[model samples]
Target: MLWFLFCLALLLGGYYIYGSFVEKVFGIKKQRQTPAYEKEDGVDYVAMSTPKVYLVQLLNIAGVGPIFGPIMGALYGPAAMLWIVFGCIFAGGVHDYFSGMLSVRNGGASVPSITGKYLGNNAKHFMNIFALVLLLLVGVVFVSAPAGMITNLVNEQTDMNVSLMSMVAIIFAYYVVATIVPVDKIIGRFYPFFGALLIFMSVGLITAVVVSSEHTLLGDYELSQMFVNMNPNDLPLWPALFITIACGAISGFHATQSPLMARCIENEENGRFVFYGAMIGEGAIALIWCALALSFFGSVEALSDVVATGGPGAVVYEASFGLLGVFGGILAFLGVVILPITSGDTAFRSSRLILAEYFNMNQKTMRNRLLMALPLFVLGGILTQVDFGIIWRYFGFANQTTAVMMLWTATAYLARHNKFHWIATVPAMFMTAVVITFILNNSSLGFGLAMQTSTIIGILATVVITVYVLTKSKRDLFVNEDGNAIDDDGIEVVAQDS
Candidate 1:
């Protein structure tokens, strides 16, 4: 319980202290016109209240990753809490803040567009495909995941046998509308209600854990137990734990979502509250879920058994019901359901924006919007036929790889400006090693190299990338003071704000 409280305090302190410092490093322009006002197109660029933007951003990024990922991460013992707290504070917050602020600086552009400006055309091309694919995967996975849960919940409650494909169709329909419509329609109107449910569910579960006489919070475990590996399969902790707990710690997915809110933020000063603060908020959710998983099961071994048998979804349903009772549990389950649905809708919406930007298509009309969105829904529908587990397996690595790209992109921006580049450079290098080692060590993904071999190779690869970036930082003079990128012939890639 003490450790849990300490970790919670760390998350809160991270927002007030480190979050402010990061805001300064980015050099927020208080009087500067944001894209929300500068590019106000009523559809995507309409300025919104800070509170609404914050809730929209929070719902957009706070998918099942925080809950399910941490539930799975809890199998590794209390060490998961450490990652959720510290990784979120340092890595996720910085990554998200830069992703949003850079987009705001660049006319509400997508991460691929922003990456292209800073990281060169090749990196831009890679991230264009990378971010698009990640968004699609998020869309498809969220669709099937919620559909399945809703199916089970409905059948269990009212005897209506809900087919998974039927639910998928319904969700995809909602995604289509959410993707094509204006930001203020379904998403903005509905998110406050969903965000309220999310808060209530999180608070209620934590309260239940703390006050329950039947179960001791944190499972009566010593702080030293956190360092011990308790995985039933004996998977190595370094890369696995990091990947398993992506959103809670750090997610490249959040970068994709940031631009969505960047277009709606009315002021640069609100960047910290909307971006970094949202990540910290997610970290809290992950901590609560991790703590609940640890305490409710009474031991790591028991939690592992339930997870192995039914996966993390089982843990969510069982724990919510066990702690909150049937009535509150139903509401809690709805909150879990809402998490992915909200993210899914925005995932498709983000995909549409990225596609429009990639093709240079105007989105002012419903026709152009549908043209961009229809193809993605078609692709999403096709992907729904594939195995959910397979897509998720690839998403974990892709998510982190994308995160590494965002960090490096931010590193380049900072280094060129001659600010403290190490803030992003260090995390970028660390995640670079993590993704490299994870793929190489996992038999299904890479060459199935030994952990030592993978780690050494990962280190060497990170070193090469680091040297190249550092050298480029010294040589690159393409960016002007206004944050526009110049080509070799000195042509500006991104236009300066008028």
Candidate 2:
């Protein structure tokens, strides 16, 4: 009961903090009267209303990571939920909200462009290359795990050939929505509704799990039992915890979504409501999953059996439904499917934006960019053939590393602008340190050495660029010609401009 109450308090506190921060930073009166650039046709930008902006933002940020992260976190017992919820608000939510705000202020630039502004040309090029590589790994591997699970769901539920059915379903659903739904209309109608549904479902699911379970006490299970059963020596709780939190806490995927959503934000005040609000919603989802895991499986052995028989999604579905039978199962399936849609759309939009910017193509010609992104999707579909868990693990590590790089660059930029207060800097620094520690603690000799090499290069690039930017701050700090202060290389800085 106390645990539940604590979680509720955290949720309410997070809402307050996120909402207050958004209003304080990007309130409506600060929004620019008009965007600096001419409105592009065909793209969602000019047509987006406030409601549409809200929905698209919600959809773009929701992904499979949140679903699985909390489940994995439960390996450390219910105590892990505390960290996942709080860490998300303080570390993940802030990182995402600020990233969007920074991009909007800069004219809707991506993270790479932001890095370039604070770090320099060389750093920008390196980080962009790194981000692209990481995103490709993320898209293919990250998308595949859920694809496989959805395939399994189709095979079990409807007997429509597995892979083919999953592919057709995904393509058809996204295609119909993308083609018919005006981008702005989609955001307006879908965002708030989707967000509300997400919250309700999460609360309902958590409440159901907690209330129905016989065990009310928090840590009665043995720690040793957590690692008892395994194929190879069971993986430690720390590795799983780090990977799980990485997925939930700070993902590189958020960087991609931040810029894509920036173009349509109704006003600066909306940044807090949209970006940070969505993250809190995601964290709530994570908490529900964690709670479900605890209620359904009392020990690690039980969790392993569930995963072996049905896979992680099944474990999650069963956990969510408990004894409600068919209705519960259907609801579980629908929620899982809906969760990934937001992430997928954001990925598609981000890729298009990157391609458009790279070629200096007009945003009105985004159909051409969409055509370009198809091959990448095909490549991702092909890669789905590999083991889902292995691919997911690799993506999780890569995603955290990419996020750290982004935060490092963002911290430098904020410092230059006199916006790098303790609130932002402390969490950013802690996340950076945590990623480094996780890497060092988990890797074997060869893999660890490679990670160390990458870390060194990234650190050196960031440091050199930061020193250079600080030295040149007098020239570029408040200037508009370079697009340095507002939009980092043309990405929108949501809060700054609003």
lDDT of 2: 0.62
Question: Can you write out model 1's per-residue Cα lDDT over 154-257, one digit (the tens) per residue?
Answer: 88888678898899999898889888889998888889778878988999999998899888888678877977887877877988999999999999999999
Question: Each model's C-alpha lDDT?
Answer: 0.90, 0.62
Which numbered prediction scores highest in lDDT against the true structure?
A: 1
RMSD of each: 3.6, 5.5
**Model 1 CA deviation exceeding 4 Å by range:** 478-498
User: Candidate 2 at 90: error in angstroms?
Assistant: 1.9
TM-score of each: 0.96, 0.81
- Model 2 Cα lDDT, one tens digit per residue, 168-189: 4575356334523345555445
Q: What is the lDDT of residue 413 in candidate 1?
A: 81
Judged by lDDT against the true structure, how good is candidate 1? 0.90
